[model samples]
Target chain A: EAGVAQSPRYKIIEKRQSVAFWCNPISGHATLYWYQQILGQGPKLLIQFQNNGVVDDSQLPKDRFSAERLKGVDSTLKIQPAKLEDSAVYLCASVTSPAADTQYFGPGTRLTVL
Target chain B: DQQVKQNSPSLSVQEGRISILNCDYTNSMFDYFLWYKKYPAEGPTFLISISSIKDKNEDGRFTVFLNKSAKHLSLHIVPSQPGDSAVYFCAARADDYKLSFGAGTTVTVRA
Candidate 1:
């Protein structure tokens, strides 16, 4: 079985530029998550989706960041007018049962903003 | 407010020895704890997990111990191997399945 897939393994943009990251979770996985991992820091949960419905996104920056999981299989995270602080690896993960902590992650998209 | 914390920034262990990584969390609401391994420029992979109900969960060379009373948990790698070298992250989950992570601890397994 293949693991979670993420597009554009790396991306570089200016501070004011916009960028989008895509993710495709594993088969039969109902839960999808997006995490931001800054340098020397652990991955922080940005948003989570249970199938097509959103489960949580309290820590998400609603003004600059947005994510959607249409039909609940694939997800896309977009950042508008990116900031220097937004330069981090965006990781996508999925799990069959969301109640526990068994998340399988993709290779992640490293975003570099100058 | 950082809920989970890994005080040690790095750890160095000789091969065939034990490697213990510690974590402390402040949120008592977190009912599940997990450990993840991450390589440079790569996303973190799930290493092992333990529920609040159990104090210890072991799988092969990896073992995770949870202390709900102290809000502390730990991951122990027995007879550490160079292949196990990576940044280890400790995470906690609340009732809503939202995971709170701590700063990672980079582990170096010396051959």
Candidate 2:
């Protein structure tokens, strides 16, 4: 019954530097997601993976952000040439399946780009 | 261009009183709505959910009401407790698997 796990609960990087966040979803979960949450706003979906395959990434900024899930169990989100606007919390979540609506979230990596 | 919006940035209610949080969505295709509660430094946790077909769903002291015609939804917590203080996010899902979320409302339950 362990929940989603994320690494480096907090991160700091300079503008134009690269940063990466990691996520390990609940065991047996079939769907994983990455989200960005700016201050005062809710988490915004960045990308979704359905068992090592992308389900949706329309909102992802391909020019700077990318994510991948290997073996459908763990995921990593990367931001290259980070901008000041990228100073926000990067959250990782997972759902049991496409039929399930309940999403379990991790503590999130708070990225501060200076 | 935000599809879901929670207008209230924060709310304060006395313990044992009622706390009501409102949310509005612009999309007509959204059929499933959910509420999540989050504490500082922690990710959001699923609180309650209501499908479009139903007007109200209740779990213990928490209730969610959805108005399809107005594209509005609300969460109500009765006899609010100090532990209930947290940010609450409203989210909606359309035909697709993605969910649209609103800027959350922070609720403070004063003892």
What TM-score would each prediction reach against the true structure? Answer: 0.96, 0.98
Model 1: residue B83 alpha-carbon error in angstroms:
0.3
Candidate 1 per-residue lDDT, tens place, A54-107, comes to 888888999999999988899999999899999999999999978755889999
Worst 10 residues of 1 chain B by lDDT: B38-47
Regions of candidate 1 where Cα sits further than 4 Å from its true position:
none
| Candidate lDDT (C-alpha), each | 0.93, 0.94
lDDT of 1 by residue, B1-111 (tens): 999999999999999999999999999899989999998867788899999999999999999999888899999999899999999999998887778899999999999
Best by DockQ: 2
Among the numbered candidates, top lDDT falls to 2
True contacts kept of each: 0.76, 0.82
Model 1 TM-score is 0.96
Give the candidate number with the greatest TM-score.
2
* DockQ of predictions, in order shown: 0.77, 0.84
Across A1-114, the per-residue lDDT of candidate 2 in tens digits comes to 999999989999999999999999999998999999999888999999999999989999999999998788899999998999999999999998866878999999999999
- Predicted structure 1: lDDT: 0.93
RMSD in angstroms between candidate 1 and the native structure over all alpha carbons: 1.2
| Clashing pairs for predicted structure model 2, backbone only | none
